[model samples]
Target chain A: MENLLDKKQSIIESALELVHANGFHGCPVSQVAKNAGVAAGTIYTYFENKEDLIVGIYDYVAEKITSYIAERDDDSLEFENRFFNYWRNFTEFYEQHPAIHGFYDQFLNSPFNSEKVQNRPNMWHEWAHMFFQSGMDEGAIRATNPVILSILVNTNITSTVRIKKNFKTKLAKTNVNLDEISQLIWAGIKTA
Target chain B: MENLLDKKQSIIESALELVHANGFHGCPVSQVAKNAGVAAGTIYTYFENKEDLIVGIYDYVAEKITSYIAERDDDSLEFENRFFNYWRNFTEFYEQHPAIHGFYDQFLNSPFNSEKVQNRPNMWHEWAHMFFQSGMDEGAIRATNPVILSILVNTNITSTVRIKKNFKTKLAKTNVNLDEISQLIWAGIKTA
Candidate 1:
């Protein structure tokens, strides 16, 4: 059973790397299987089809991110400290796994992310909602819609990561301090 | 000359629709030519190759967005009103042209957005910088990196649009007020 799980995990990782390099249509199931060092039939054993494999990649990334953040999360910490911790953990996860960003950038816009797919329960979004809701409950954050707050904060992190990755040299030359993004978001959402 | 320009525009429009519907790998130059009602050879007259056509789409969308916002911009208004106006105009543009959102989501992540490609000057970014800088000049907004501000503001608009489009029914059911996003951003960036 453990060996079977490992093979499934390996397939997910391989598919992510290939899809990141080449868009969905470019990375067919055969290519994914070759890259995973598994028989094409093995892929079907794990996923229903190519579309299933793509959705599996999203689930894999989402779980990885949520687990990383959840491990670092200290509910006992002050709300502001917790906020920054979440920000740092989220950014570091993407920086370490740059392919995840690429995958999301393509996946979210692709046809695979249909209404049915998006409406499916997502772990990462649920984690974000609970985090923001806790802050509001404690009167540390503004008493606005948690969904909106999550969107505002999460988008900032993802966009920052995207820009930093895309314009590494250009950003280094300029005084574009990324920390200010967190500070601004904190200021905007914190209870005045 | 005008007729020739119209042909070029039609080709671009058709390609955008095709690319949005089908990812870059799925949309071939031949299909684009057919959709545009032009000869396959005619696409070459305006664009050098598939790669050139993809870049042309980016340029086309950028120009359309910047021009739309620019035409609605009223510099004479107070900075805050100008800020909201920019936000409203930007959101409305995407809402009207949902395909632009789809194109960006794919293009920005695809191999097409190479460093050499991204390094190309973009009118939209420049306009955003100037707009934010003007706010700082008037002592209305915080004195932070304009690039960061642009990322934060623009990402919020795009994300909100994406969510609204993707989760139309869910958003309507929840208290996910979209306007709160702009207000929160303003609260975060405006001078205390």
Candidate 2:
């Protein structure tokens, strides 16, 4: 059973890397199975079909990323520290996993996303909502819809991360200051 | 010549609508031609193939959206009014054309975008950079890289517009005030 679980996870990671590099349609199950060094039939034993395999990868990756973000939370810290820390942690995580970051944007824009979003259990969003709610209650953040606030903060971080990825070498050479971006985002969401 | 131009444009528009509805892979060149009421041969005259058609639709749509935003700009107005006006106009435009908005997210996430971004002329970004530069010079906007400022503001608008599209009816019933969201973004980049 442990070996079976390992095979399943390896299949998911292989598929994720392929999908990141070649896109959804371009990456086939056979290629994913081969990349994982498992027989093509083995994938069927785990996932129902190609659609199932793709969706499985989505859920698996989401869980992993959400766990990373959730684990960064420090309940002992104040709201601002907790919030910015999570944001910084998320940026670092995605920056480290650039392929996953690329796959994420692809998955978000895919048609399958809406279906997954409607049906999937999203702890990440829940955690974010709770954090925003706590901040509002503490009078640290504005009294806006938690969802809106979450989206704003998340977008800014992701956008900055994306910009960093797009021109990392040039940006490094130029010494572009991304530190200010976080402060700007915090300014947007913080209470007056 | 005039007739040819109309036919070419109609074909592009049809391709956009179909691609927006069904996605790039789901919508084939034949289907686009069928939807546009044009012969498959006609598409070849306007575009090299399916790949070209999809990329062409991206450039066309970008031009239209940029024109809408650019048209909203009043040179005489102060930076704040100009910024808000462009935001409101962009929101209204994308709200009315949700399909185009959906297609836009897809296009942005697609590999084709990076290729296009590298090779294509971006009048919109240039215009936005100029606007931010003027605002900075006027002491109305914070001193930062104009590209960073543009990305921050643009990301917020698109994120809000995405949320609005995702849950319009429920959000409408809840009376979620997105107007304040705009003010928050403005506050982030504005200088007192």
DockQ of each: 0.46, 0.48
Off by over 4 Å in 1: A25-31, A136-145, B25-31, B136-145, B190-192
- By summed lDDT, the worst window of 10 consecutive residues in model 1 chain A runs over A169-178
Scoring only the A-chain of each prediction against the true A-chain gives TM-scores of 0.93, 0.90
Rate residue B7 of model 1 by lDDT.
92
Name the candidate that leads on DockQ. 2
Model 2 C-alpha lDDT per residue in residues A65-141, reported as the tens digit of each score: 78898887887788999888988898998899877787877877677675545456677677788888889888887
Q: Cα lDDT of model 2 overall? A: 0.78
TM-score for every candidate vs. truth? 0.86, 0.91
Q: Each candidate's fnat, in order?
A: 0.50, 0.43
Model 2: per-residue Cα lDDT over B78-144, one tens digit each: 9889888978998898888887887887777677675546456777778888988899888887777
Q: Distance (Å) between predicted and true CA of A73, model 1? A: 2.1
Q: Report lDDT (Cα) of residue A188, candidate 1.
A: 68
Residues forming the 10-long window of minimal summed lDDT in candidate 1 chain B: B169-178
